[model samples]
Target: MSGALLEAKGLCKRYGALVANDNISLTVAPGELHAIIGPNGAGKTTLIGQLTGQIRPDEGRILFRSEDITDRGMPARVQFGLSRSFQISSIFPSFNAECNVALPIQAKAGHSFRFWTPAVVIESLRGPARELLGRVGLGERGATRASVMAHGERRQLEVAMALASQPSLLLLDEPMAGLGAGESARMVAFLKSLKGRFGILLVEHDMNAVFALADRISVLASGRVIVSGTPEEIRSSREVREVYLGEEFDA
Candidate 1:
């Protein structure tokens, strides 16, 4: 079996008296899709922040590819092939979708951003940018401005930007947020197509999408992982149902 692509041990983060993450630990195996689900204010965002290097854990070790990266900053982590998508859409609103993605491609290629030069004019960047857009189902929308695109398309652009880094592990924070029912289904399908291509650590509130896409699920409650199991096991757990899923959950 493939080894872990990312691992967190004894992760703890605190904000004054509030414990955002309490000694949480988990692993993402190579090419596996691991989803983290919890109710509102369950510390899911904090956990994702720690993984993406946006917030440091007060105590813990984060390992990627068997190397210690606990102290690495965001840029360093990206350079190490770890990328993230935020809870909200993060894209250059004024730029066309292709250019927005091209910027990351240029960065990943080690070229400094050339603000004076139009990104599309750079053949090396635009070609791959269009390809990435296609991967995220925004192929025909490449020339569309991000601000003019629908919310769902903007989210798709964010995913394409994350992929430009060519990451081994992708930390996705609430990719389904703000998506309508149809948009959420399309996003789920897109994410499913990406499975086995890269290790995904998904943080989402959409249980349907979570159950449909995850290979394994980790339920977090009050800053701790209450349980980690397959979809079936999670659905059957009394504690999980009471604390997070509730009796109303069909399965």
Candidate 2:
């Protein structure tokens, strides 16, 4: 845990009388994919909000690269190589896939977006944008408008934009949400290929994808982490099965 890419300790969030997150803690090691899974309203999203600086925890500490970031804002966190993709795809609908990605690259390069220079003319931003798109399996769709791309492709583009920040740890929220079987499979394969390149904290409801991609998993129930362990340990956990995985899971 000394060199953990991201660490959260005793995070607690409250909405008046309701407890959203209760002493939630987890760590993502460099190049490790850690999955967080639980039923709805288990405080997974609240926990992610705290980690991403969108929501302040009433009690907790967040550290990125061994530096305390609990007080840091979203931009500060991104500057520290922490990036995230939301469960809902956010992209520039009117812009081509390349331009959408280029904006973030441009921002990271300290360039003004107000400049009239066309994205195609700015080879510096365009070059890396294309590569990031390629990494997300959207190479051929770079010229396609984001609005026209399928839901899965838009998800990929959003991921490409996150990569534009060159994050050391990427937090993904429900990457498989709203995908059909084929699209889900594609996303699974894409995520599988990213193993060991960077640290990833994934919050997903897709059990198949979670088991396939996670090096370790943390199960949340009623705003608390019920278990945290390797995939095999989680699979063999009777409590996890009973609380979430259901009776069909062979203990």
Candidate 3:
């Protein structure tokens, strides 16, 4: 929090006549986890798209580590250490876990398309990949096929792959989606351990995970930020209760 790691100011995005984001603004600090939560069609993912440069904002600016990135494309932003995951599962189904993790490092190591040589042969990639896998608690499972691993391990593998990029900021779009109780719990624990290392912007539907991990919560409704507050404030907020969280609980 000493210096804001990411800053989105007055971000506005529109599609035809529809306003997807309305003057949204927020900041992420180093090693802090911030969450964006909302129901379907509420523009949570749209906001994420704007934040990570997947979608450009009609107005407003994005700054990462003090650099203005308002117009930078996805690849440029990612190269500057902004990493993200999708709502759906993201992995190399055919690649083993280590290979999957190593690929990102290979890309960063400047040998991404060296198909003539084995990827693992590049020590720059393999060493970092193995270390990242170990950091995420997948130390022994690196050799397993990604598809053959359990659902939770696959998710973990995705995380390892993301980390392999050496990102300073991580944008997670529902990493816990489709996970059962045990898998979800493990994912939560894994996420908790990642705090204070990277500025993480987490988009998740699981309230339990959000509450447990978020240092701050921003609630969106109909493409606008309705509320932003700490977990206790969010849990006790009448606006949050009346709008979405309460409904999620009742259902």
Candidate 4:
């Protein structure tokens, strides 16, 4: 609790002949924004899956707030204050934005969806759901159905839903995946505003957003971390330049 908010030590995952994540170790300090950048097939997805309990590591330990949770399932992890947002938007197409977030709020409150009533109709769930929608810059769009919202707005809805559980550590996998320049900039600003409030482990491909929002960065290549350091340090690293950023990184 006093040290790293989330710690992964010697994490390894394998699939027959291929090693997805090899001895991966990283620490995200309390309220720190840590970014993971890598090329395709660099095992970023595998590592994120292991962290969120979607995939189990072949060998390692995962600690959250000083407690080991290597074996916890996804739901258990969410209950323990670890929440994840996927690369693709996961929202209820038929539900309004407020209802979408309220469902997670209900889930986090240990409620069952046995009732046929909509989540937004439940006064108790609607208040906090609306608050979450405002927190993610969707305050005015609460009544917009997911099917009618733009792609970027849908992604914002996903984040609001993730936050409905009040997670201590947020694993964001490519929040900027399919956004246009303006949308991406808005998202980067939103994430920047969240820095120091959440211990964020961001797996992103947008180098501009990554460098702008990350407190520290880790570069993964061939299923292993090649370097982890501050943005300036990473930018100057010859290894990162050659393998990922390339010679025209600054240009």
Reference-based lDDT, each prediction: 0.89, 0.89, 0.83, 0.89
* Candidate 3 minimal-lDDT segment of 10 residues: 111-120
| lDDT by residue for model 3 (58-116), tens | 99988998889988898788789998864225587878888888877867656444654
- For model 4, residues 59-175, the per-residue Cα lDDT tens digits are 999999889999889999999999998534468899899889988898888755555466434787888998999988999998999999998988888899999989989999888
**What TM-score against the true fold does each predicted structure earn?**
0.93, 0.93, 0.90, 0.93
True lDDT of residue 116, candidate 2: 58
Q: After superposition, how far is residue 76 of candidate 4 from its true place, in Å?
A: 0.7
Off by over 4 Å in 4: 87-89, 111-121, 245-248
Q: How big is the positional error of residue 68 in model 1, measured in Å on the Cα after superposition?
A: 0.5
lDDT of 3 at 121: 59
Single out the weakest 10-residue window by summed lDDT for candidate 2.
242-251
Could you tell me the TM-score of candidate 3? 0.90
| Preferred candidate (TM-score higher): 2 or 3 | 2
Q: Can you write out model 2's per-residue Cα lDDT over 1-251, one digit (the tens) per residue?
A: 48899999999999999999999989999999999998889999999899999999999999998999999999889889998885344587898999999887877766454565664447767788989999999999989998899988888888899889998889999999998999899999988888899899999988899999999999999899999999999998988978864434442
lDDT of 1 by residue, 138-179 (tens): 999999999899999889999999999999899998999999
